[model samples]
Target: MTLRHSLLLATASLIVSATVAMAQEPEVDCDNAQTQMDMNICAGRDYKTADNELNAVYKKALEAAKETDEGFKDMGEQYVGAVDALKRAQRSWIGYRDGQCELAGFEARGGSMEPLLVSSCLADLTRKRTAELKAFYEQEN
Candidate 1:
């Protein structure tokens, strides 16, 4: 290849390598996150963490419901419906929380701040859901 073509190929390779390195770097390291985009990505990950905790708590609650189903009729529910009620309530709560957070995100829709807004909302709601499920846990105890 010609010298000029060789230089251009090397330059392109360096740029691609740098881009990949930046993409792989942790956003939370060394005060490295200073941009709105980076903050949004971090916020999204935070929401995922909170959602994972909520999921674990939710599974426990559902399992508890299932285990207690036989006594639900004894408690005057007329049948084994504890698990069914818990499932329905959880489904409705998820829908309500997502719709509420989506409305909250509309304030920054189509903008760099949108993901941060949505993710903060999600984390907040998921934390609240976790608390609510924990209260149910208290009842089960």
Candidate 2:
């Protein structure tokens, strides 16, 4: 709940969001694919790559946060609250990603839905959770 920690969280989120968005861009050939399964698989691979990159960013953020004075000292219940909120946000995002992807593929034929579903879900969830995290930080500040 220090300004530094809040800023770090915000920066990390932005970095991860940007990285994932960039990594998940679909290939041109995917659009012209005849099979739904192919499209879905292709999309899934792209999303998986982005997800891995996002995990790396999260790990770096955790390390950066832990190096902070507040993170080291573990001061105040607000710090704990912030960590809890972040964990909850991550879990919720995973759920949203899986559910959205499943729904997108339900009526489709192939992997084509992967990129669309993941990108859409990630964008929506990231925006919503960023707002929540910002609010939490504001209240803590």
Candidate 3:
């Protein structure tokens, strides 16, 4: 690649990673997000928070199922199936979320507002997934 192309690629990678990193950190002030860039940052941050909670809840649910399995001497197969199903479901959900958000961003594709649209869709989906995982964690209680 030409130097210019290489630099452009590197800059794009950095921008994407930085947006995700900003979302993962707890420093974005959504209320004061006055610019399109700031709004995108805040939306991404929200998605990251929700996604984190979903992971935590899923882990707990799996752990709890494993613990419960001890009560049944021959239920190892059942436990494995349940865990496998949850893992598969989560993978599918992630693919769906990403595709859905990418499509939503088409409304402003290549525009300054595209990131905000994509991030907002991601946050919405992540929150729903969080609730679903939380419910699963609580269901066995």
Top model by lDDT, which number?
Answer: 1
Task: Give the CA lDDT, 0 to 100, for residue 8 in model 1.
Answer: 100
In the range 29-134, model 3's lDDT, one tens digit per residue, is 7988887878877887777787787778888878756555555537655544556667789899999999999999999999999988998898889888878877
lDDT of model number 2: 0.59
lDDT of 2 by residue, 31-54 (tens): 565665555555555555656656
TM-score of each: 0.74, 0.45, 0.72
Runs with alpha carbons beyond 4 Å of true place in candidate 3 = 1-28, 68-80
lDDT of each: 0.87, 0.59, 0.81
Query: Highest TM-score among the candidates is held by which one?
Result: 1
| Model 1: per-residue Cα lDDT over 23-63, one tens digit each | 78464642576888788878888899999999999998988
Error of 1 at 22 (Å): 13
Candidate 1: lDDT over CA atoms?
A: 0.87
Could you tell me the TM-score of candidate 3? 0.72
Better of 1 and 2 by TM-score: 1
lDDT head-to-head 2 vs 3, winner? 3
